[model samples]
Target: MRKLTWGVWLGTSMLLAACGGSGGSQDSGLEPPPQDPRFVADNAQWREERRERLLQPDGWASLVGLHRLELNAHYVGSGATNGIRLAKGPEKLGLLQQSGGRVWLVPERGVALTLDGEPVKARFELKPDTDQSPSIVGFDEGNGQLSLLQRSGGKALRVKHADAETRTQFGTLEYWPADAGWRIDASFVPHATPRTLEIMDITSQLQALPNPGVVEFERDGARYRLEALEGEEGGLFLVFADRTSGHESYGPGRYLYTDAPDRSGAVVVDFNRAYNPPCAFTDYATCPLPPHENRMDLAVTAGEKRYRRPTP
Candidate 1:
């Protein structure tokens, strides 16, 4: 009887212990959030966007021309020779026109202009700006003159190639799997005073931009916030750095956006979509840096991985 009682007690104790362990595991912070269905569809869309942008319009494939006139420039269009040669005077003003079905730049006579391997001599007709202007402009439409006006009052299209050191040498970017665990349905955390955010440049210069409210969420029982900035696209632009940066991800930081989300304060921050800044590929862009407030103390392991490339 004594032996049987001892065995029963031992069995009961083990059963109770197992139940307690199971409860603790259910609430462990080690596991990621549940997967959301919408992210699967979003992933497909991003892949297509990447192909159209990075693959087809290889930056190295285009010719960059910087036309700076001392007073006026003589040139050729596509169809005439000893063409509309005019001096650097008032006569140069009305030579070219963009009207009807086409635009024309009647070049002065005896001038030569070869375009994309075609021996284009001076002519009375004009041709199109052959390159697709893919880079989003810093100015508004009809304001393309901004690009025409070069940096530091000079005129030049700083050249970058498709086979650029960054592009050519890039290995596959690392990413946290598209598991729904990272997407936390979040809500707006409004601020009374609009905050000013600064993005640090390569030269360690800071540029200030305004930010409205922020989006907030709770992770590991701690509340975190990301302030919002105005962007051309209708979404939030978040520049943030964390402990994982430089080690598991881009050294400077990773970026995220506030796309449309559901009710759970759950926003899909697809790490796979994280990519290099324009600075990575070329020197001409003015990309915004992460704000100081966005810097997180913890490691954000989910999302796009660091870009691996050969030394430039």
Candidate 2:
């Protein structure tokens, strides 16, 4: 991934200013109470940490290619003849063969690759991301990584290279000014029985994700609710949109992860920490769209703004 340059960091304030000011005061026509200094400092720190993570070698910025595997065996390499072409690395990398709902990798004669730090000299099963222990094949002296990702009942090879142009040319992450009003306290109302929500991704594939409950909150004297997807980490994953979508933010939506409700059924829905999905940075990402139930009519002028990809 690209290094987080000092220019990007210095330009953050300017970008935020250009985007606009705190929407709360302007929308409500009433000045909000002064934010606590501690809250402002903590929020700034969180945004900084989020930026650092995105610049990591294996983060979303490193994603350079996504190739769907054919039912039959096919060569994969940087060569033009290969069925699956890589943007960088060896010319003749390997062969991907699919049979009986399983996929295997067969490295080229002179190519070297490793799985779990052990040299792979023979054909081995390649596990998809859905597997408990997915196999990550590394090559190019560990600067490139490859893994199978299952989507729409099919498998695709996700390729990540440290030297990807996208990573090297990362620009800035825009945002609106932090406002305490956007940090709302919501009521988590659990469902009597667990339910499922059919979420559609940018690829038009539908996934029946778990819907654990609903979070109800009020803003500007208007009530709203957002369906929460049960998170793998005992939290709640929210894919939502408001009036800001397609105008000031990513067109599809944004994502938010909040801790599970407390005993009293309370969860802090901090829009200040809401972030754009992976699709905002790279076209290779398969990000889910916000469910209809989670869409709001009000303008949520917090969190991340639309990303402008840097020139290569």
Candidate 3:
């Protein structure tokens, strides 16, 4: 874990104190459930389920390699001579050929692979994730899988191995205590014309994601707003940061997703549900950074804390 400099810690402490001080608006009549035994137990159960999902064979933690495809043919394997060398698996996996914006995966002789659980002995077209039914090639007897991913205006082979070191050696997640006070009622301010936000990902690639509107809420008497991105599931996605960002939380920011607004155009901005981006867990993930407008002046002392991997 990276230690926070004294100056940074002091600045964060001052910001937290200011945000929690008397300058904020009065309580908005929203009452949260008491912090009883049942409440604690429920939160514990949720965290457990989250951990289980992370350790899944194909989850983010299983990511082992991300190899950008070239315009020409390339050999993919664990061998050093291969164009895309994998960290694990057979020395000679297959060959990836790209032409005319299309990719094909040609299997090596006697190198067994499965497509939809059926043996694949011949070459087949590989579709990027942008397609509805992209090809998923299974190798290493289902322990390793490969798929085409469209990223940064190009295609790449994403490799997932069940025995990925990160997944096998994952440390427990830490969090600030579950505090219902962090759940605030917010109003959705829709834009007459929806726009696109240029989100810069960890890979330094810019993507234009949908910007539906803004969510306005008050905390500690001070009002704040966060631009909401249209979620794939008809919900709203928020990438934001506060004073806790560089000190007690993931330095970049945290992500939150909320259901669509109700009839009254009201949504609940639950900071308690804020979670660290996939980048926090694995370096292979390409996570979007928070936009300038989404950064908050106040401190959000809720949600998951900085994940410090346990020492060996």
The lDDT leader among the candidates is 2
Candidate 2 residue pairs in clash (backbone atoms < 3 Å): none
> Which whole-number lDDT from 0 to 100 does residue 297 have in model 3?
74
Model 3 stretches with alpha carbons more than 4 Å out: 1-34
Measured with C-alpha atoms, the lDDT of residue 280 in candidate 3 is 75
Instruction: Choose 2 or 3, whichever is better by lDDT.
Output: 2
| Rank ordering of all candidates by lDDT, starting from the highest | 2, 3, 1
> For model 2, how does the per-residue alpha-carbon lDDT over 141-221 read when each residue is reduced to its tens digit?
888889999887578999988898778888899887788889999989988997989999877789998898899888878
Could you estimate the TM-score for every candidate? 0.53, 0.88, 0.87
Which prediction has the highest TM-score against the true structure?
A: 2
- lDDT of each residue in 266-306, candidate 3, tens digit only: 98887877888877778678789887777777778778876
lDDT of 3 at 56: 96
Candidate 2, residue 131: Cα displacement in angstroms equals 0.8
Model 3, TM vs. native: 0.87
Looking at model 3, residue 236 earns an lDDT score of 93
Cα lDDT of all candidates, in order?
0.45, 0.81, 0.80
lDDT of 3 at 33: 54
Model 3 whole-model lDDT (C-alpha atoms): 0.80
**Which residue pairs come into collision in candidate 3?**
24-220, 24-221, 25-221
